[model samples]
Target: MMVDGVVARLRELDGELAPGDGVAVFNGMYLAVTEEVRDRLAGGRFDDPAAVAELDVLFAGRYLAAVAADQAGRRPAACWRPLFTARRQPGVHPVQFALAGISAHVEHDLPLAVVDTCRSRRCPPQQLSADYHRINDVLADLEARVREQLMPGPDPLEAADPLTHLVGCWSLDRARDAAWASAQALWALHRLPPAYAALATALDESVGAVCRRLLTPLVRRRSGGGQDQGGQDQLECSGLPSA
Candidate 1:
């Protein structure tokens, strides 16, 4: 599947979902990032655009598969369950949704995608490292922009805000580094089907746990306990439970 195909699917999803839906929020952010990647690939920014394109498809396929499964009333990949479960919840901030999706995609799907790309291309994970990092560059940019757009109010960290905790806990750099390590591990276990499957399952579940933490709450309580949009709250979901 071309990256354009991934962009199209995401666009369709964005169109289908309500503006405030958590999945839609994440999907919208992802679509923008994918579009940027597609443009860069078309412009010859990557060293090996074909390999990166293949990886992009495989990476996105995992998320799309989860979406399909959920839509079909089946369980999505565990890593994706948090966002989907919280999709209609009243409290989750858009930044939280976006970061949780990022967590699921980067920590769990990325390694598997990298390994799949390697097996399909008959190349080592090392061969794909440069392009992989290049793509990470794009995601890094998205993370920064997301923080600014969604939490652009007072300095979250300086204000001792609860949202500071939620968004602060997720590190794209760490996630990407761990993903590369996982890809190497998955590649090394190519001949060990049972082990590979076990690692994959563990990864899926663990990433789900991480996302659960990220989507915990976004707003902090005000001094007088009055609620306002983007106002302070004990970091409850603004209107939902903090826990």
Candidate 2:
């Protein structure tokens, strides 16, 4: 239930930050939390439940503080503020988008890790073990379904939905490799405490950008070969950079 605890804490924070100011805040918080967890795990500190709890508290507190500042019309106070603000708006709430992205990442790893750890425990609770196994099974099935939907076909337009295609591509096991590679690039650019700041920032920005590109109509038009004068005018109107 280690990952369950993490997910629970994230949900609690999400609830606290309801009516989110925008995706930037949520991205910042999610990156902060996950990077904390990842670092702790990498450092072997997550073996102790108490340590994990402490980490959760620290992350939750920091995220809440940032959210409060955001709500007050003050800039977020952190190294990643510029990256977060790149896509955020003054009034748009990003809570749901952030939660979804974070949840997807968690779903991709945490539950499976919890199940494995529980199975290896000397005196694991049977009920908890069973619950984790079920969760893992369900996730596997869902991933398989998503893969089936994403398999390339003769008609390229059949996979025109970029959001679905992106999700499917990243659902593969190799997505972790991509994420790690990207994190490494970020690390090279901006070193931070515990060597995790860059990794977290990278994940937050990459995920946020992907979501915006996939879900925003402005992005879709640019990708759909709409390069006529009207399309150019629309692009200028939207203030998006040229493709």
Number of the predicted model whose lDDT against the real structure is largest? 1
TM-score of 2: 0.35
How many residue pairs clash in model 1?
Answer: 5
* Cα lDDT, model 1, residue 127: 94
Candidate 2 per-residue lDDT over residues 1-243, each given as its tens digit: 344455565566556643543444444455444544545445664335543344334434444454567668786443223323533443112332343333334322232233233334423333333333333343344345434442334424533344344344344244434433443344343424555554454455555444443223223234344666433221111332111
Model 1 compared with the native: what TM-score? 0.89
Cα lDDT tens digits, model 1, 1-243, are 788889999999999999989999889889989999999999999999999999999999999999999999998988899888888776577888989999999999999999999999999999988889999999999999888888747554545466766688789999999999999999999889999999999988888888888877555456554555454534444443222
Model 1 CA RMSD to the hidden true structure, in angstroms = 3.6
- Could you tell me the lDDT of residue 203 within candidate 2? 57
- RMSD in angstroms, all models? 3.6, 11.3
